[model samples]
Target: MPPIHLLDLSFQETAEAIAAFVVETDEGPVLVETGPHSTWPHLEGALHKLGYRPEDVRQVLLTHIHLDHAGAAWAFAKKGAVIHVHPVGAPHLAHPDKLLHSARRIYQDQMDTLWGQMEPIAESQLHTPADGEEIEIGGVVFRALYTPGHATHHIAWQVGADVFTGDVGGVRIPGGVVMPPCPPPDIHIEHWLESIARIKQAGAERLWLTHFGPVDEPVPHLDALAARLLDWANWMRPWFESGTPPEEVTPRFQQYVQEQLRSEGITDPQVLQRYELANPAWMSVWGLMRYWKKKLARG
Candidate 1:
């Protein structure tokens, strides 16, 4: 097995908040996630520290096409690296206008500052792998498992006994508390729960989250995340039925998350803010609310 090195992106000057993994394989080095384009410099510095250059990366595997995970993939694609992603996400990367437009509506003026420039990757360089597909790069075999819930295009990469779970497995800071990152536009609770079961059945020993580092206790971590997801979704179901404005729900959800963090011995305002940024309470509110609304419509 190749050694996986964690590269700290140092997001917002906070440690362990966002990370990219470097896998040293027999053929060469492969980068798992690129963090975000805004943090490309930090990624470059990390690569430099590991004695690698931008061009040194010949293959880049993405768990999803979310900005935080695959925003900088174009940078590597420009360096002649083949960008492998889910079929659902390949078109968006090839033509990023719609993707950027949607994100701009959410990020507004903070777009450039928060995500940096997102360039379009040539379709020729994009490889859309099917679910259950196995891709071997640099003598490393990665199995792409379609894990939808957080995002329809999301894929969890399984390498030997380890899995690179983008956002499908949820977020956890250094502390051992698991929190669901239920961002909107695509948050299917049923699908997500199924995805969690899929990951557990994979028998991975560890889960490498893009938000932070490796989680050694896979089963327990995933179980906690599943429970947290249902708890949050159930909490929002009533709020959705009541037709409470999103504005009010956002703050209430924030308080709820803050309380959870406090109980876990994380009370600092700054730390709480970092966790919020990683997985915003407002986004979860919107996501859960949307999920319920859609279910209700179907029923």
Candidate 2:
């Protein structure tokens, strides 16, 4: 296993809310998850602490192209880094207007402060690796496992005996429960469960989550994530059917999730806030609602 240095981005001035991993490859340092551009200065400082500069990272492997995970990738690409991503996400990175527009709709005024700026990466710099394809950088090899439940273009990059599970592995901060981040436009529950099975089959020694950090126990962590994913989806079913406004469902869902956290013994206010930052309740409310609407329409 190559040396993996986990860099905390301290998203929203909150510790452990986001992370970017720098792996030592023979050729040079390869970065996984650039995090949002809002945290770019912090990420640079984290890299510098480890004696690396952004230019030293020639390869950027993204688990997915969401703003939080891959938003800052273009900055690395500007320094001549090759961006590795899923096929479906390649175009979006190369042409970010639509992606940016969608995100703007969700976060109007808070966009700049939350995610900073995102520019288009040249198509030449974007490499869309096939599922199970391995790319060797320096001497370390990274195998991309297609895991698309959190987002349609998500991939869990497996290096050595461990996996860098973007959002597919769920968000689990220290002393918090594992919660799947079900953001909209592609929150298919069935596909997500299958992806969980795929992660189990990968036989990783540990699951490296971009949301916070590593999980030593893959099976139990994943099982809990699967259960919670179903639990949250089912919890939102009746509300979706009742045509309840998301505003009404959001607070209830937030309370429900917080109570679960409180039960799990995470009483610290900051810890609870980190959970919300990593996986916002309102986003999940809409995401699950959309999932139910689509699933029922198919019946």
Candidate 3:
């Protein structure tokens, strides 16, 4: 049997929408990510169409507690889905005040429209996966790779040749091209590369992205992604070193990034927009620059 089933959350065409994966295990069905709560009905509908009731989904595996990935987790946990997330992320999911506040800072009034309500998970249901740990649910093995660069709490799930890379491998758009999602507060170039190496070491033949579906050619996609990440880091380092105003730096970075995408064969502007929506180019500029500043300050 296939290890997992793709639940098309119908958010793909909708604005601010994303995909979610459901892994059917021997014990029960395990959902890899819970999109925002507003999409909960759609998710439930998808699950039902797949022939399983909500309770049949006994466990929810989160690559991280980012709202898009884990927002609807609370709704499931309320229905008795055991929540699994990173240790660092467990607290935030258990008490969503910080998560909400941080998202509010970034998204402001668009919160409800962009990402639905984030409900709190009960402490008892929260399972903080350790690095290199293998979890077997109903005989299906899922090894958690502590891939932190997208976020300090991020994890990538591996099951045979298919690995569910949350944001660690970046977002693979409709055409299957990979792009880095260097969002703020937790984007570190060193750690992001390390995470990529970790995923490669795990030996997944295909990478399943949370933003969409399976990527068959892992090597070239990953190669392109790595080069772009480095290029972005290198491009932003000088700006940070020069202490350019954040206002001036962001727009400059976007142009450079857009040009890089064009060089890499992404010809369509709307395709670029999708990439921007999934992992805003501006955030990459901010995240790397901020990381550089923090690293320098520490020294």
Per-prediction TM-score, please?
0.98, 0.99, 0.93
lDDT on C-alpha atoms for all candidate structures: 0.90, 0.93, 0.82
Which candidate has the top score in TM-score?
2
The lDDT ranking, best first, is 2, 1, 3
What value does the lDDT take at residue 298 in candidate 3? 84
- Give the per-residue lDDT digits (tens) of candidate 3, residues 265-291: 887766676777677766777788888
- For model 2, what is the C-alpha lDDT against the true structure? 0.93
Question: Tens digit of lDDT per residue, candidate 2, span 1-299?
Answer: 79999999999999999999999987878999999999999999999999998999999999988899999999999999999999999999999999999999999999999999999999999999999999998889999999878898889999977899999999998878799998797999999999999999989889899888999999999999999999999999999999999999999999999888888888999888898999999999999999999999999
Candidate 3 global Cα RMSD: 1.9
- CA error at residue 213 for candidate 3, angstroms: 1.6
- Residue-level lDDT of model 1, residues 148-212, one tens digit each, is 99999999999999999999989987763789998888899999999999999999999998877
Candidate 2 global TM-score: 0.99
Candidate 3 Cα misplacement greater than 4 A, ranges = 12-17
Clashing pairs in 3: 27-138
- Could you tell me how far off, in angstroms, the CA of residue 174 lies in candidate 3 after the best superposition? 2.2
Query: Model 3 compared with the native: what TM-score?
Result: 0.93
- By lDDT, who's the top model here? 2
